[model samples]
Target: MAIDLLKRVDEIQAIGAVPKILETVAAMTGLGFVCIAHVTDDAWVTCAVLDRLAFGLKPGDELDVTTTLCEEVRDTARSVIIDHVAESTQYAGHHTPRIYGFQSYFSIPVFRADGRYFGTLCGLDPKPIKLSDPVTVSTLHLFAELISKQLDAENRQQAARSDLSSERETAELREQFIAVLGHDLRTPLGSIALGADLLALKVADPALLPVVERIRRSARRMASLVDDVMDFTRGRMGSGIRLNLRRHDSVHLTLEQVIDEMRGLHPERVIAASIPDLLCLDCDPERLAQLLSNLLANALVHGNAGTPVHIDARQQDGKFVLSVSNEGQDLAPEIIGQLFKPYWRAASRSGSEGLGLGLYIVDQIARAHGGKIDVTSSAGRTAFTFTLDNVRPVST
Candidate 1:
């Protein structure tokens, strides 16, 4: 019998006409209040109902699933009758009859085809009645099966939507990754080729050795960028990245490393640092280095080369505050708001050769470490600041 009920439910779902089926069920049942509730451990919560004569019961009301008559039928694996609540030991003091102004009630257990109990299909009346008529009870049971079918169909549709959304997002990320890879790879490859050509020409000048070193540094940076991109992708897809947390002089060491790299690109710029050597933080050293490098590079590319770029890191109130400021024309309000959005670059610099993923990646890395990034721009200066927890000062 349960198998037949489940088969009927499948047929109802296959029809794919929820509203029409519900209307039909209401008319066929001819009951004052007809409801379907799904059983949970503690309650039978209403999922759908046709209460044309609204008796204040809503779609999500919960009744005790363990003790309710509907549950008893499900547990005993048979239908029970309550001819009149005032005469039954099981329901004499029950609230359902008095609150809904009903003297008679009939409920049938809803079950999966396998006879696994789910909830009930119930009907109520304001006067004494006999709903035990075989046809009425069977029809209500069939309607319950149909409700189960509707829920199953809805779940399948939602799963399809989720799958499609995931695919679309993956496709987009692949496109962005390809673009960044091409741009980053070209520069290092070009430098290595140029250096090889120079060496082949027997240009043995001592000054040329620096050029070879420069090529090697660029190649390493490119490799690091690739690794960062891979780690970021994994993290975004719900995988955790390993974080090496240790107390190290964060401000002094991180800023020094960043300044050294930026000076190689923009020797004319005055990059100033005001960081305490003793300020320490618990962070992944490599990720922090990448974050600072991105910020410094952004400043050099967008800000005036001759003006000063200021970096400061300090320990205050158990947090490490780091800021990078540059003397540049203030960023437009609209651009500042979306600075960290992936693939977002200022419209004014439309011709710049950037994939615009740097700031976005930095923001993600910061968030993964339980920190936040913020920016302020006005008049002649723009500053980006971030704070990290568990900051302390190192002892000499």
Candidate 2:
């Protein structure tokens, strides 16, 4: 139980919202001490703590189970609230309050999403205060639920990573887990994005706005990661990527929007896009736009900083061909084919810009549209081109 508890604590601590959640809990409760404790039959260990009173409890700190009130909460699988430890006739005889020397204390039992009793979200203050309020209880409960779901996500992700490494044995399980984690991530991510928006509008602290913006950016990156993983799972474990192909006369505009957005993100970089023939194609407009985005982003990430990336979408021989070209160190002849393979990262990529699935997803999108993607590198210039014929299928 302690091993699992420590693992879960590590998982939840990896999540970005944990710090905010603990801070908000302390602020809302007006308590000098708040903690998430992992309680077993014999030991109570702090998973996380916020101590304004110099309580000296860090993650993994252990306390005597008999000396902590959470032991009772764990045993009963219910919350314990003591508004005034000295005034409560029931608690006057209890040793925990006297041992801890706290006048007010509350603990809400926390459970895993699978309904296994896990721990407690508990807080205490030296002076007596009103603790049985509706808002406080509800907030703690909601935060507990959120923490549980976040822990579940982290556990799933960890398993997926493990399975990914031992590909031959656990590939199938990894695919299923990745699919589940990808879909399940959307709700909590949406909540975090919404919370960031609320912070932007409600909080006026000049220094804190950047932190909120970082949260918002991190959330967006997480959403992209989820999408990439989902695509890889579907393309690998199931059939190839299915598409909703449709004829669009204004597909050029969609590509333009993608370029504009990319430029806004990296304004100092130059990206030139031209679709002179007024693109009209029987393809998935959105997926085609995604392919272009992936290619352009790759170019920006690996291309020479002083050079401009060029993108051209053209109608040729009754087929739509889109090409992205960038000046960079020419990739070797051997490495070009692996660019579209799942999780294959080029050695030239300097940072963790992606899991190398961007190009793979782009390839899948192309194939879903009854098309093919190609790449060429020569004389320090690398270009990726995608082509779909006019005889596109109506549906997948």
Candidate 3:
């Protein structure tokens, strides 16, 4: 059951050269009516037409498939040509000529590029014409071939456009879905954190203090994961990480603050910092703090827990340079290359592992500031460095 008749008809009509083909065909063959028909197992529908004999058939018109000679053309995958139907031996008494009163007729089978039968390039007239001449037959074959090739090209282009549209729609839905989920989840997380704070103040038992702290930590981690997911979607969706850039007189203090916070979070781990005093820089302090925090968190998680993580921030040659390094087993070239990609993690997993978006977000922030993070892993130390040139110092 080949349904969707209109779609098939439109496909044929979309070929801009189809009308000219039909007109040229009718003129060369001396036929009063010529058309391109979409023939199927049980249907014969006109797709395009050049009618001169009051044939009363136009595009989208249909005829009983069983009553037309085109049906034989479709069945045989061969052309049916008749110069004088009434004088011919084969079709002289054929019911088709008497029913439609066409003395001269030709229906050349037109095939799709995939070798499936499509329909026919056909013409008809009341007066007999020299349609059996080899020159005329060959020219008609060429025209039919031209239409077949053109139809295939049009269909391919339409399919490509449709695929692109579908891909874009899927990407939009994915971004919207993740953005909404991240936003909706924050409200409950905030409530849990607030409740934990209230519990900590009221609970006097030493046994319950740790429980209250655990709840606070879990809520905060969940909130951080939500923020990472939202940022990931935004970065990939062509809107990079947002920033509020301004001159800060104590950018080095911002770096020190991040290190101090990380130390408080993991009091057991040792961290070493070397940042200059009164370092002035034009940058988004909060975003830089986040970038440094993510790097420190990643280092603390993956670096050798027994070794101290080192942070170095400085301003030299009118540029700000920051690097975080840890002593650990060397990472392979492949692993180092994929470290900045989102959701990428080494095979080993610890209970403290996050959603693996830290480095990816770090890279995004660096790029947003017109800088890039460089990685060098060898020996027993791995370092991630962020460099921003042309820095503007804060006014005195």
lDDT of 3 by residue, 70-184 (tens): 8999888999999999899999999999999999999999899899988999999999887896756876887787678767766776677668866565456545655665676
Candidate 3 error regions (>4 Å):
1-162, 349-352, 394-396
Q: Which candidate should be chosen as best, given lDDT against the real structure?
A: 3
Model 3 sits at a Cα RMSD from the real structure of 26.4
Per-residue CA lDDT of model 2 for 1-396, tens digit only, reads: 467767756765665445545655664455789888877888788888777878888888889888988888888988888889888989978998888888988998888768888888889989887677664566577667766766666566656765655543344654565477557657766886798899999988899898788768866776676677678778878677767777787787988999999999889999988876456777777777778888898899889999999998877667778899999898887799788877677666634455568899998898888789899999999999988787432231
Instruction: Show model 2 residue runs off by greater than 4 Å.
Output: 1-170, 391-396
Local accuracy of candidate 1 as per-residue lDDT tens digits, 255-357: 6877897787778878888877766677887778878888877887788878888888878778878888888788877888899875567766554433465
lDDT ranking from best candidate downward:
3, 2, 1
The alpha-carbon deviation from the true structure for residue 2 of candidate 1, after best TM-score superposition, in angstroms, is 61
Clashes of each: 0, 0, 0
Which residue pairs collide, candidate 3? none
